[model samples]
Target: MDESYFVGWGTLMLINAVLAQGKNRSGLNWFLLSLLLGPVATFFLALSEKK
Candidate 1:
């Protein structure tokens, strides 16, 4: 596997974490979820209402 793939995944995780925090959700939880769900996590985050 390419190193860039890992980097990209890590970057997405950070972005998801930030997006989760913006929605008043748990950033660390979202970050870990991103590691499993990847872009799906982003979709879920988008649909979540802000607190």
Candidate 2:
């Protein structure tokens, strides 16, 4: 695998962490979603905050 791939994934994880914080979700949930759905999950989770 290329080094850039790891870097991009790491950056996305950080962004997901931030989004989770903003949504008031547990760190564990965010971490799990990061593993399961990557960056897209973060957006979906954020959008579902009020539901």
Residues 1-51, candidate 1: write the lDDT tens digits: 999999999999999999999989999999999999999999999999999
Q: How accurate is candidate 1 locally (lDDT)?
A: 0.97
lDDT of 1 at 43: 94
**How high is the lDDT of residue 37 in model 2?**
77
Off by over 4 Å in 1: none
Residue 17 error, candidate 1, Å = 0.4
Q: What TM-score quantifies how close candidate 1 is to the native fold?
A: 0.95
lDDT of all predictions: 0.97, 0.73
**What's the TM-score of each model vs. the native?**
0.95, 0.70
